[model samples]
Target: MTLVRVSRGVRMHREAEPDLAAHVRPLTRISGSCAASHDTAARLWNFPEPERRPFDRRIHISRPSGGARMQRPGVVGHRSRLLPDEVAYVDGLCVTTRTRTWLDLAEALEIDDLVVIADYLLRIPRPEFEGRAEPYATREELLAMLRRHPGKRGLLKAREALALARLGADSPPETRLRLAMLSAGLPEPEVNKPIRNDDGDTLHAPDLSLPEYRIAIEYEGESHGNADQIVRDIEREERARAADWDEVRISKRHMANGARRAVEKIAVALRARGWRQEDAA
Candidate 1:
């Protein structure tokens, strides 16, 4: 077996690329004080960043304020006064809790990006698919975290993000679309609200909907480009048509220029469905 050196005193088979856990676990084990934090913890919790980037080579480790600073070749060390509950063990590796990770991210990301992550954390999880019934974190819990760390680096950004964050946004794009519409002076749409037929059977759960105007907005991400998903999307559009709902389908192209194009598409659909510009005001 060919062994590749990953970190000091740590080696792995060269055939397999080291995953986040593989890279961080050893670094955390270097001392009881160290825990995975910042971008590293966000990745572990599956928070969606504004833009995708290659996995950073350096591991982010945090120790208590008085702990000795880590001097390692591949580690970015931080010193903060962490509450006992702020850090937890995930899959045997020490890491900051989900809410703390978001606070850490607020320092590095824009307000929109922070809102995207906040939405991700607050979205209800599908127990059947996600293996858990509860959201990753809640608004109150996040607020409490903010209160605890009044002097934290990104307190203002985190608070702003929390104010904009809402439940039911399933993806970053969905959250961005909602934010864009708000920015364009459109009426706020319900997130992932189910539209049902007269008999009360659920027909479609649109990404965003204005039930009063029968407008359904769907943000189709990259997955929707697949042949199989395209067929399903067509069928979904037909259902909206049959139900007399104006369905606005948005794609990556529509997300250009701060999602101005997406807002325009949705605005047109809303107008056609009897929404008026003055109504939004």
Candidate 2:
């Protein structure tokens, strides 16, 4: 039997073969063929749990000589047309496209898992095969799918993906906070808006702000407690104080108790800033 080298010690014949044990051994790990559809596809597709074994299924490989078939006894072959750029050679097997990865993930994922997978896929940098894949659709079609399914897990995933793709590397925390606030029936604050001083110099851009009430709500995550961040926070507070803006900071702890107390605190601050209590209510 002639063997062609693919990876460090992996080999495959120039022609197809029936048993691919040697080729399958190294490629069965997490980062290897498991990431692609093959056996993993069954899991993603919600197939019945199979009894634990050494390998999942055998895959078929083609051989060059006529009538000489080599069947890999325990590997399942994932058949899909891949774009030239999407095809990645990892460990001796071809890695599937991100779109294919997501599709497989969607097939077996529960609602929440599906949403997360969709969100993660959308957030990936320059995701290849998005519009070029088999289920071809224009960007509008994709957006329409999201709009049609608003408040659904699929829509949440689509929205998250769109935001990540468009915003580059910005954290999604602010967006999530805003969504949670809105869902709780609070008026949406202007996002990432700058608070300026009398001299027109920008003081700080609060994550959320109410211009009329001179109120700001800042979401303080763990990063805020760092030494550099503490200094910046002091400066921001001083600027806000000079500008007569009442700043309210909310942490994950505050949010954990629900937005009632946070909302009430903001409402009181707004009232003190000459905003009508009724208007705030």
Candidate 3:
């Protein structure tokens, strides 16, 4: 019988198929009551990450103190004292709660990367939630969680990232772009800003905007390339122009390759419309 190794001393039929999170789950159990946490827990809960890792990455697990670390060929174990509320279940899989998983990421992620994940968790999908999707975790909840772990390894970085976390980002790229702008010393623009005409009727809302400067920065996702979306985009551009707003559209290519240039263009537009460096303060 040919068996594939899933984790140290754990194996299964080669044809049994594998789900990354599922495969990771048993490792936690085999290690004696640990839970899939950190990146593994985040994946099981569908948490948005700045970048998705590969299947081959080691499974991450966590447990309370006084237990043996789950050292295995394919597992990376974390030892932490978990609170009752910090452990939860999803689809019957034991994992860290949302805020707990996020706190776990502090030491493992860069400040900007941490902020991206933080913003993602707080995003509220009002339309999908019948005009009120409660946030996955409020900013206050995150701050409180950080406060509880004062001596944790990366608590300071976590606190800083949580401070920049906002509730309106719709995608990881939006969070990335916003951070880029702020890093460039630009004032934070409103996310999904509303546009209204002289009569005060809302026309459209752009992805990010500085209303005082009448400048909008929109992230054009791959879906924007479709014929129907392209047509609508053209119309949206025209309406934005009609509203006397200058726009700088950013795509994944711009984000991955020419982000500096894209952000500079936005700065130029902002400056042209009277934004000063001191204004950001």
Candidate 4:
């Protein structure tokens, strides 16, 4: 008969020798702040995967005096205080709240990147907002701050951030398609702007519209595959034509190439409409 001594509190393989010290080494390497969350009871007992990023590898733990005495190599420590509810114990490690996680990420990432992360975090299933005990008064408060900032850079950043923080499923393909246009250095078009007939009846709202150019771009997604959607799209196109607007329809396949071709097509259409690229630029 073969006998094996399985280590308690850590998984052991019968076929392999267990290195208890090696297993504990990783735990020791974690910064005290991240260890709070990553190594908390919820993660250890429940065995939940930690949502750690490359940036989190350098977490710095602060002392009660709101200062960091020592930091691990490659880790940066900030002297800050966390509220009680904002803290969670996991696997004997301290984890920051989701709100704090987002705030930190927002400060670190570019507006576009921050928007992507914010969108991802907001879409998380049943997210808990921790604004009551944090620097920001509320999520809306933060959004308002972004909106209040001057210039297109601030407005666009705020818009993207707010869009990311919106509660719902992933954004529609049209929204993503429009964002690609902005990222491609094209002038931002009004989103879902309406085109009305002379009779003032609402005709159609194109996915993106540049009134100055009298041009509209429509994103045809998988939903347009349905017979009803196709009919509606055609009707919309005809109405746009009647309204003297040059309309271009782009499918998901076309948008996958990152809007270079779409921008060219738009430029051509604008040229035909008596507008110059330099003028638009």
lDDT of every model, 2 decimals: 0.87, 0.50, 0.80, 0.52
Residue-level lDDT tens digits of model 4 in 1-281:
35443322234345665342333334433445432221221222222122222234333333223545435444344443454555545443455444444443443445544444444444424335533332222456446444443442335644556664433223344445555666655566776667776678777767678787778888776788999988988887888899888898877566555556776777678678886646645
Assess every candidate by TM-score. Answer: 0.88, 0.47, 0.90, 0.51
Against the true structure, candidate 1 reaches a TM-score of: 0.88
Candidate 2 lDDT (Cα, whole model)?
0.50
Model 3 residue-pair collision total: 0
Rate residue 243 of model 4 by lDDT.
82
- For model 3, residues 155-244, the per-residue Cα lDDT tens digits are 988999988888788888888888888888987889886887666878788888888888888899989999999999888888878888
Best-performing candidate as measured by lDDT: 1
- Superior by lDDT: candidate 3 or candidate 4: 3
Once fitted onto the true fold, the runs of candidate 4 whose alpha carbons sit more than 4 angstroms away are 1-102, 107-111, 116-140, 143-176, 183-185
**Which residue pairs in model 1 clash with each other?**
none
* Candidate 3: residue pairs that collide: none
Residue 274's lDDT within candidate 4 is: 80
Alpha-carbon runs more than 4 Å astray in model 3: 1-5, 51-56, 126-132, 278-281
lDDT string for model 2 (53-74, tens) is 2224444221222322332334
- For the record, the alpha-carbon RMSD of candidate 2 to the native fold, in angstroms, is 11.5
Which stretches of model 1 miss by more than 4 angstroms? 1-17, 52-57, 197-202, 225-231, 274-281
Q: In candidate 2, how many Å is residue 172 off? A: 4.1
How many clashes does each candidate structure show, in the order listed? 0, 20, 0, 17
